[model samples]
Target: MMIYTIRASRPDEWRAQRTLRLEALKDPAGSVAFVNTYETEEAFADEVWQQRAETQSFIAEDEVGERVANVAVLVESGEEFEEPQTHLVGVYVRPEFRGGGLAAELLGAAIEWSWELPEKVGRVRLWVHEDNHRAQAFYTRLGFVRTGRTMPFPLDESRTEYEMVLERP
Candidate 1:
């Protein structure tokens, strides 16, 4: 079995974050999985990447120390949310490191972090592209259920993105 070390990414690791995102964007499903075009992200200033690096993002590193997966939990706060909530963002596993439970581990790390946050979030949610059945299946297997809520895909309004949520028990 392959062993991975899951940990929070430091702010100074924005370069690593940028590299991983670019790699994910290069994947075949990249066009559907991510809203950001490679060109747009590539053109972002270092400050943008630095801001992202400050988020509560988890990274899974292989035995050789190569970061293989990532999952970021964005804590949501607003009048709409009765309690603090977390939204899963940028969830991805490199094409090569998939199928070894690395994705699950990355998610677990992110969720656990959310659960222990100062805000004490009770719910975690994510958005899955309507056409991305593989991702929907994966989220379902991890106990996430569709909320039946949909939003126009950011990149294509005609397409949809469905909201899925997992309540803390």
Candidate 2:
């Protein structure tokens, strides 16, 4: 595998971000995990991509400067009863980029950012499609544990998503 660089996303790179995200969303595995379809992905406006860059998005670039993978951490404000939590979403790697440990690197960076908060975040969590054993295995390897909290799929009630969490400890 060729050496690649991982860094925070930049607004100027929104087009590249869109391209990579579309590719990821088109992947077979992405179909279940990602919420976008090919048509919807193609119609996303430039502003959406820009906001993603301005927010907590990270991308892995190849030696030639192509964005091959992306992992974004979106912070969700907690209600009165819950501590502020960080949601890990939009994680994907180019089909060719899989198995190179890029996902781990991207996820590690996201977690590190969450831990940097002045008031520590209670935990980092993500939702994985129940049938996505590959992703479950990857998250497990990264020390995330299943919390047994399940939700119906947004587009398909027949399928369920499992809530998984990784504690700072």
Candidate 3:
């Protein structure tokens, strides 16, 4: 059986975080799933990676100590929302580790962290590509509902993305 642990990432885990992100950016859905490209992220400075590690990011590590999955929550503020919103992003699981509940675990960590924030967060939100039905179903199964908001995909403006949200109770 495979053994793994899910937990928050530390500042010193920048290297591991970068490695995992690079792997995610190479996946088939990477173009639609991530706002940034692997080539762009590869050029980021070490400090950028460190800052990412310091964010509310969680990682799933295998028994051999390799990071196999990651997710993060960012508290966002804008005139469009009445209260601060917790935005979940950077969700990815290595292909070999997919379908093992790792994505759910990562999302649970982000949701739990959002609820524990110092300030009140109105809800948790995430964007999934419109063509990615698998991800849409996954988020729906976790209690998120489509908000009917659509935005142009950054990588390909011709395509669209949908916003899904889970309100805080």
Candidate 4:
């Protein structure tokens, strides 16, 4: 079995972050799973990634020290929510590393980290592409329930991305 070291990504790891994100953008499901395209992200400067790396972006590196998966949570707050909220985003698992517990384990870590956040997060929410049933099922199994709320996908307003939330316990 392959062992993985999952931890928060550092600004210095921007190159690795960019690499993995580009790979994810190349997936067949990328259109629905992610709003960005490889070309767009590829053109971003290193400082952009450095800034993004400051978030609760977690990465999983395999035994050989190769990044195989990634996940992140963004703390959002305003009139839109009662309290500070952790929004799950940027999730990806390399094709070769799918169909296993790695994603779950890494997500659990991010969830645990959310609860530890100084902001006192009330819940963890995520957006899933309307047609991405596989991702929907995975989130459901992790205790997230549909919120019946949706917004127009950024890239294509005609399409939607639904919401799911898991209250912190």
Top candidate by lDDT: 4
* Tens-digit per-residue lDDT, 1-169, candidate 3: 5678998888788999999999899899887789899999999999999888887788999998899889987889778778888998999998888888888888998898898887788799999998888899999999999899999999899999999999998
Itemize residue pairs with steric clashes in candidate 4.
Answer: none
> What would the TM-scores of all predictions be?
0.96, 0.93, 0.94, 0.95
Q: Mind giving the per-residue lDDT tens digits that candidate 2 earns over 60-93? A: 8899988888888877665752776788989988
Q: lDDT by residue for model 1 over 71-130, one digit each (tens)?
A: 887999889898999999888898777888889888988888888888879899999999
The full ranking of all candidates by lDDT, starting with the best, is 4, 3, 1, 2
TM-score: the better of candidates 3 and 4? 4
TM-score of 4: 0.95
Tens-digit lDDT track of model 4 for 12-66: 8888888999999999978899989889998998889889877768889999899
Cα error of candidate 4 at position 141, Å: 0.3
Q: What lDDT is reached at residue 7 by model 3?
A: 89
Off by over 4 Å in 2: none
Against the true structure, candidate 1 reaches a TM-score of 0.96
Residue 71, candidate 3: how far off, in angstroms?
A: 0.3
- The superposed Cα distance between candidate 2 and the true structure at residue 5, in angstroms, equals 0.7
Model 3 spans with C-alpha error above 4 angstroms: 78-80
Per-residue lDDT of 69 in model 3: 89
Better of 1 and 3 by TM-score: 1
